[model samples]
Target: MEFSELLEQAGGAGLFQTLLLLTFILPCFMISFHVLLENFSASVPGHRCWTQLLDNGSVVPANITPEALLTISIPPGPNWEPDQCRRFRQPQWQLVDPNATTSSWNEADTEPCVDGWVYDRSTFTSTIVMKWDLVCSSQGLKPLSQSIFMSGILVGSFIWGLLSHRLGRKPMLSWSCLQTAVAGTGTTFAPTLLIYCGLRFVTAFGIAGIFLSALGLMVEWTTTSRRAVTLTVLACSSSAGQAALGGVAFALRDWQTLQLAVSVPFFAIFLISWWLPESARWLIIKGKPDQALQELRKVARINGHKEAKNLTIEVLMSSMEEEVASAKEPQSGLDLFRVPMLRKRSCPALVTSFSLLISLYGLVFDLQSLGRDIFLLQVLFGAMDILGRATTVLLLSFLGRRTILAGFQVMAGLCILANTLVPPDLQTLRVVLAVLGKGCFGISLTCLTIYRAELFPTTVRLVVLFFLPETRGLPLPDTVQDLESQKSTAAQGNRQEAVAVESTWF
Candidate 1:
């Protein structure tokens, strides 16, 4: 008998699985907050060089409006808006006159702002740009900071991704929760740009660990029957968090407070994570049938199984003996590229992930270019993600993952490409196309994540859904050999037909 059969007797899709799925929502929410925080925190607002009254040491008349004063001190940019970076070397008082039509100010001596900048605080009270004077020559630093955060994720992905196999998902996950809580909260107190970026990097590192461990634990614990819908619900919760962030940022307006608001809640989440069980599959594979037995019995009891007390280490070992024997030696990430079939699948999966992320993030970071209220746009984007991912729940039930992934990939690319061809005068059409493209893109990403999860062995599987669980209700495969030989274990007993239908597609 396979582990799934044992799991069924122990109460598959029971109370334990349901609670574990629900527990995942908050961490996903927190992840969304930190991942997208740059939208509000680093946003650039309307700004111009700070203009001072003439060197005569005379105070300007109080009646003179700031806008009028700006016209005299700052030249118009290419679009005839007040220039952001340059200011008049000497004030051209004539430019303030409504009747003054001369373009002579264009040739007048100009220099970069010597003083600071005057920011428009109508939307954001303060952002990184306003805080660190990151406009003009310093503008590159903003993107650089975001890059630093992403780089941390990249590094952590490799680190935690490997460690989760050896150290166990729950332990790494607990450490990650604590790490994110500490580092993310510490970001609120950073007195310098360097310090802020450093803290953000560390927070992102923890975020990677959280994502891998949390998702791994969720998948490992859940029966295949509920995996698709369970993941959809998790994705929906994350999108909800993203939508909520728009309102939160709008209300708070201040960057530090917004950062603090999102980070502090993880402490509670961290504490709650302690109560979660380790992946029983991982334990059995690691030669700890005793611990696995205890966990299974615990799950059976919590799931209200009357036979819970009957589960012994002997039963647990017998059930997963094949799985345990196959995992006698640990697998490494290199095995993905070293083994033949794994190499074939790994290359394409890696490429697809890289491409999808570049496009998705490109669209996300360029939200301001849509020329709408940033807060509303954030909500709209989040809503689209929810709509797209929610559709997957029904789609995964019928369509094969490859078909959905390929179709959405083509659809997303077409919509985004077509968007660029549309004239700028058609603002509404542009926004519609942008939103539709993003929605399709979100769907494609969801497909890729689930698809990738089905392709590898247990060692790396915990990191990326490697060869553990197949699509639908297949039992978790413990080795590369098991993965290659996988058939619908969902065909056991009376539920065979429904599960066969679920697992039939690639």
Candidate 2:
């Protein structure tokens, strides 16, 4: 079937199915694309060809045996020829048959089906290509593409946060889910690298927006007691998504096939949107007290409380009188640092946000570059994340947020330092240290999310939380420059001190 027909079929499905699809499937597409982009060169044609060197240390035959392994040893004199040195050849292919007494090994250039094939010796300079390096070496454009995608996420978070607050969460989330799915699917057909990157950025933007809106909506709709658990659950879902990506990518195998498999869920999630009601708190904020009351009544009814017919705006107003009175005037992003009270709250929140971003992004990119064993690290991190989130949810009421956060940070820092010191021989210990670092980081990240949301007042809470990650980018631009400056200053100071000491001795 055609792409348009597939989309039409998905569109025909109800909102609940659509929401379910987006909530679960969209992540698979994002992860699968990331994996494929990193691995695609492995299967490309001409990637496995070998090169043979002639007498003068120059490449001669370009299409040598695919499985030939060449060892080069430089001759003592410049006048040396390829024929002057002895060459040793090894079998390039091996075959295993259950019925055979001994497995037949295909030797050198000889056909596997032919019997008694002899190995052909070649010059040491001849180089047989192994598997092509799957490392993403697209340099300028690829890194730029990745950065643009991340930038879109930053932009989308801000846009969606505002949109959710203004237009209502349900609409924003539903729209974001649909847009992300479309963008993700469109990426597979992108003719140029630039176009592919652009589509990826758009898809990432929509995903960020949808996630932010959904989280906010979930928090606002849940009771105070359930809010923390719900948020933790969401975090677990994200971690689960990451883990699921590994399996999904492995199963799909092919890039296009993986993309399609991942996208299938986005089309399914759209159906679940119908069941998601607008947030009562958000409705009240938007001057829809009647609708808010109706939603609240539904909640109360679900909790086995009779819907009070006499419940009025005044009663709700009386209940929230203290909160309403304490709701401060709106403030701009800059005002966070200007106001003393705001600064106190903002500093910790900013630190938390920065730490969380570094932990998450650092781990993500590290896993992307470090292949094969990446699955093992991801499993470790995912398990830690789930455990950490669950533990945070359990301890949030008992442990002071700042204490827990600080402890986690200290632990994470120590783990990192320890990782740097781990002996090369103690690989197992190194792995343990890495896992410990991830676990500590995961706990800190979960705590920061909850603490940052709680520190800001209701009016500015969402704004502050949404912008926290974006603000982290500002300091990073000058970070290296500032570090170099400090290093230079310190070195100069040390030289002056040394000169003074020498003068005193003289």
Which residue runs does candidate 1 get wrong by more than 4 Å?
A: 54-58, 62-67, 96-103, 106-108, 463-473, 487-506
Model 1, 1-506: lDDT tens digits are: 26666677778878888888889999997798899899899999989887777322367767777677777788888888888999998888787788897576666478898888889999899898999999999999999999999999999999998889887999999999999999999999899999999999999999999999988888777766767777778887888888888889889999999999999988998999999988888898888888888888888989998776777888888877877877776567888888886777777777778878888888878777776577888888889988998888778877777778778988988888998999977877877888898789878877776776666667667442233233454455567776655543433433442352232221
TM-score per candidate, chains pooled: 0.92, 0.66
Estimate the TM-score for candidate 1. Answer: 0.92
Native-referenced Cα lDDT, model 2: 0.51
Q: Point out where model 2 deviates above 4 Å.
A: 1-137, 140-142, 318-331, 368-371, 423-427, 464-506
Candidate 2: give its CA RMSD in angstroms: 17.2
Q: How close is candidate 2 to the true structure, as a TM-score?
A: 0.66
Candidate 2 per-residue C-alpha lDDT over 320-428 given as tens digits, one digit per residue, 9 for 90 to 100? 4444443334545555577655665677677667866766566555553333354455666667766776677666655556667778878887877886787766777
For model 1, name the residue pairs that clash.
453-465, 456-466, 456-467, 457-467, 461-466
